[model samples]
Target chain A: MPIRVKLDERMREKGMSLTELADRVGLTLANLSILKTGKAKAVRFSTLEAICKALECKPGDLLDFDEE
Target chain B: MKQSSLSLRVLKLVLTVCWWGSVIMAVLVPLALVYAASSSGNPKSDWEFSYTGYASGIDTSSLSAVDRDGREGRVEFNEGTWVQVFYPIETSAGRVKLVLLIAVVSGVVLAFFLVFIKQLKDILDTVSEGDPFVEVNAGRVRLIGVLLIVGTFGQALLRLVVSGYADSSLRTTGFQLDGNFEMNFMQLIAGVSVLVLSEVFRLGTKMREEQELTV
Candidate 1:
């Protein structure tokens, strides 16, 4: 839960809307939003790969360790 | 298909049909019983639903025609008909009130059943949404376990009350206890198993959540 997904920042850096990123990564908007809100319990490697592929970022760029 | 696919199968439709059917029947059966009680015109100083028997001639010593008091049971032996009925001494109003109480109990049982059905429906909704594993479902499953445990005792109490109503008249003729008390462990174990299943769901949900975020 402490590992936050920096999806909002990455999407902004890529100048991509949440919906557009979801479409490009083959993920649902709700799930993407869950990640952005830090509500996601975990993430799949394939999903991270897709997001990275779509946003042109490394996993570390999209996820940050923060103390709860 | 994966194991999670089981929740998404046609079983959901089956559960929907059963839920509707049981809810309707649960409401209607109690209503009909109460209506019968109201119409029976018998003095209801006590509980009495109805009872039928075979026998002829009034056994005056049977304490019916003489000591007609607040006893309950539909027992009567006439000179002609080989049937008898008896009821405990209760005001008509008291009997109606008892019937209403029974109906209320039935409603409570139905409500619990409906809650259980709602849990099933929710899980099915998740399955349809392509996810059967969720943390909320663990709580729902635990609720079902508690219901089952409590339901066994509830059903037993209901049976006693219903039978008491029907046999209240027996005091006029005769009354006897046909069985000994027993505590059934099977229902208890079944209820406990459900609790275990809920724990399983909890673990499954945790794993699924982790997998979802593993990226």
Candidate 2:
């Protein structure tokens, strides 16, 4: 839970909608939304690779670690 | 995969039948008891039973019966004693009281069985639907285990109380019978086993949730 997904922040920075990102990454909108809302328990390496490639950013740019 | 195997279906059918049967009995038994107690022409007035002590206590040394080896030694219970007693319920008041006691005791025991069967049926429903790893199944299994353990102890307590009540009123000439309570180890072990299985299901449920949430 401490490893938070900054998908929404990165998406906003790139001015890309969730549907557009999901279509580019070949993932369903629901799954992409799950990641965006920080509800996903894990992000697969392939999924991370796809997201990083589509957004033109590193995995670190889409993820943050905050200790509660 | 869905668990629609023939054996599973048959077992589920049998359990459903048993649950309905128990439900019917739970309703009918008290009515029958009350009717029997109220009827003036009651068929039976006295109840008698003989039970041997659970442990070895009977003296078999004097018996001449031979064993498989053809020796004078026979099956020995050197410490076992068989106690036989006649319990009289001659009066209408006594009969009514007995009926009330039976109804209460049986109601509690039957309630336990009904809940256990219902929970089991629910689990089977989930399994049949190929969704057995839900968290509620773990809770239901845990409840069955707790019920089994508690029901065993409750049975022992009921036996003690009923026997003690019987012994207090019945007059005897030579020997007196006491209420003896014994723990049922088998049921306790079974309950513990189910509890362990519930924990395993809980782990499975957690793993399933994690798997589902992974993107």
Candidate 3:
């Protein structure tokens, strides 16, 4: 929970919709939404690789460590 | 997986049969008691019985009988005093009433056990499909553990009442016969153990849910 995902910001920066990103990454829209909302328990390396490739962003750009 | 499923199905079947059997027994005993009562005349004030103490008097010197209350009734060596275990006091029409009551109560207790088993069977149905650690199961197990504790206490109370009655019946109503209250320690421990396990299962279920939700 401390590892905050900045996926929404990065997605907005690229002007890419969730559905378009899901299709590009070959993941379901529901799972992509979970990632977008930072509700996912984990993001697999393969999934991260696909999402990073799709958004043309680095892992650090989309992930942030926010301490409580 | 297949074997476990098969065993579960068998267990379910056995529990169903036991439930129905106990229910049937509960129904039949009252009817039989009524029939016996009706056939025999009303309580005769002068009716008395001479009890035969054994199946046939085997030398009970080396043997002792334990009552439900954990009292040991044994034959004394030097005094020659015969502490007879619960032999049927007298086989009269009145005794039929006592037997009928006991039979019916036992059937009812069996029915309670049946209901508990049915709950277990339902939970096992979920486990057979490889989904064992559901939240409902934690509640069910806790319920069963509570039942066991409550049921044993209930049984102990019943024993007290019955034994108290036995002490008074057919003789002077005094503390002449031992009216010991039997508390089954094993049953109480089993109930408490199950309750503890239910809490553990509940914790496991919570952790599993949290892990699943964590993406």
Candidate 4:
């Protein structure tokens, strides 16, 4: 139930807006917003791959497990 | 965002109004019949009565007689006691039975309306609370379906009863039992609407479940 989506800090370091990342990854702004706000129930592996490819980061840098 | 909730609220209000309206009709119709029966000034008359062979053992002697117009009649039994029976001149017992049947059917419809609104409220509440995996009780839906079916058939039976009374020679002052073809049509439409709405709810619930699974 508790999954961490680390996005804002990485986006800032990469000098990217959510819109820019979503555009690069071919995802919707709504979906990117959901990921950024940690509101997604689960993220697909394909989506994770796309996000990583667009952000030039490993999955480890993007996702973390949190205590529920 | 709020529009859907507002629409549901409106629907709940409309359903409540319909439920109470039907209930009022259910009560008032019988009262009207009683009032009409009492206000008539025609004197009662006694007449010989016999049941057809189909209804053997029925005490036709005990059945009170009414005027040819269907007004209340006084009958003297073999015991030499005279009793006054209040019967409508234009309506038969079969017609009165149908009115009572309509009252019962209306009450049942009101009950079903209440239950459907309550379940709808529950579903809305669950959805509002963000419970994506909510399970709807299928039994409630089935109950609505059954009520609709019953109401349709009950309306048809009421129509038949009214037609029988209309064709009878009995006449009671201020009391008329007329068959309204429009009412029967409305009843049929209502039944179909309820059935369609129930199916829509079932489909919506199924889609929500599938969405949860896909998500």
Isolated chain A TM-score, each model: 0.93, 0.95, 0.95, 0.90
On DockQ, the stronger of 2 and 4 is 2
lDDT of 3 by residue, B1-215 (tens): 42375677788688778767767876786677667656555445233333211112335567788899999898543421222334433446556666566667677776787778777877877777788889999999998999989988987776666555555453422114434466788999999999999999999998897776644
Model 3 chain B worst lDDT window (10 residues): B47-56
What DockQ do the predictions score, one after another? Answer: 0.32, 0.84, 0.39, 0.12
**Which pairs clash in model 2?**
B56-B79, B56-B80, B57-B79, B57-B80, B58-B77, B58-B79, B58-B80
TM-score between model 1 and native: 0.54
Q: Alpha-carbon error at B58 in model 1, in Å?
A: 24
Query: Model 2 chain B: which ten-residue window has the lowest total lDDT?
Result: B47-56
Q: Which 10-residue window in model 1 chain B sums to the lowest lDDT?
A: B174-183
Q: For candidate 3, give the DockQ.
A: 0.39
**If ranked by DockQ, best first, what sequence of candidates would result?**
2, 3, 1, 4
Ranking by lDDT: 2, 3, 1, 4
True lDDT of residue B180, candidate 4: 38
User: Docking category for candidate 4?
Assistant: incorrect
* lDDT of each residue in B151-183, candidate 4, tens digit only: 677766765554545435344242233433324
Clashes of 1: 35
Which segments of model 1 are wrong by more than 4 Å? A1-68, B1-10, B30-34, B37-91, B156-181
TM-score of 2: 0.81
lDDT of 2 at B158: 68
| C-alpha local distance difference test of each model | 0.71, 0.80, 0.73, 0.60
- Candidate 3 Cα deviation (angstroms), residue A33: 4.3
